[model samples]
Target: MQENEVITDRDNVLFEAGIKLGALYHQFTGSPVNLDTVDSLEKGIQESISVQPCVEKISVSINRDMISSKLNGKYGYCELEGRMLDVHITAIFKTAKVDVSLAFDTELDYPLMKIEKIY
Candidate 1:
């Protein structure tokens, strides 16, 4: 019983960290951007996450790739294909660590295309 409680506590910590990272990604990527914006976003997320009690360290990686991809075609509103940025965040918690990756389509007025957990 004691061991199970410990495991649950660790799991909770990881889950909370993941959620915080996801929210940070959404907040930072919800706008149009350039290299400078990306830099600021990374710094902002790291600083914000580091202040969390469970977080010990945080790292953010941004990948810039230009590709043609479908966007919001379901409602007969099609968007032009453009550059897509992949943002990866790694949060090291006191008891665990998590990696969250998200995609942002720069063509759209609002970024933040998708988000997922890497591990």
Candidate 2:
């Protein structure tokens, strides 16, 4: 940016949303989890991310069916995968608010993070 450039709240929020999704995915993926601990894991992730700046709200959901199918015979738990997470976050900077999500896109076969809305 040039010296006179000004960053708007909308820009800040959009950037922050990407940062939040990236951090959450990297920090939590590969953690061990079973059906019994899934709920707690979701809550833990949400609470942890909620403390960050501009994070107004967050929701995390792990696909229980996917978890069950992916569990190995020897171990009753599976490592968390990006494909298993369905996350939504609302972030606000000043008057600008943005909603974003991380979810599995069947067409893309990956966890896709995208801006849902901005206002």
Best candidate (score: lDDT):
2
What's the true lDDT of residue 68 in model 2? 94
Q: Model 1: residues >4 Å from true position, as ranges?
A: 1-7, 66-119
Could you say which candidate leads in TM-score? 2
Q: Relative to the true structure, how large is the alpha-carbon lDDT of every model?
A: 0.50, 0.94
Candidate 2 lands at a TM-score of 0.94
Clashes per candidate (backbone, < 3 Å): 0, 0
How far residue 76's Cα lies from its native spot in candidate 2, in Å, is 0.9
**lDDT score, residue 24, model 1?**
61
Worst 10 residues of 1 by lDDT: 64-73
Question: Model 1 Cα displacement at 111 (Å)?
Answer: 12
Cα displacement (Å) at residue 103, model 1: 7.1
Q: Indicate the residue-level lDDT of 18 in model 1.
A: 63
* lDDT of model number 2: 0.94
lDDT of 2 by residue, 35-116 (tens): 9999999999989999998999999999999999998889789999999999999999887999999999999998999999
Model 2 residue 80 CA deviation (Å) reads 0.3
TM-score of every model versus the real structure: 0.48, 0.94
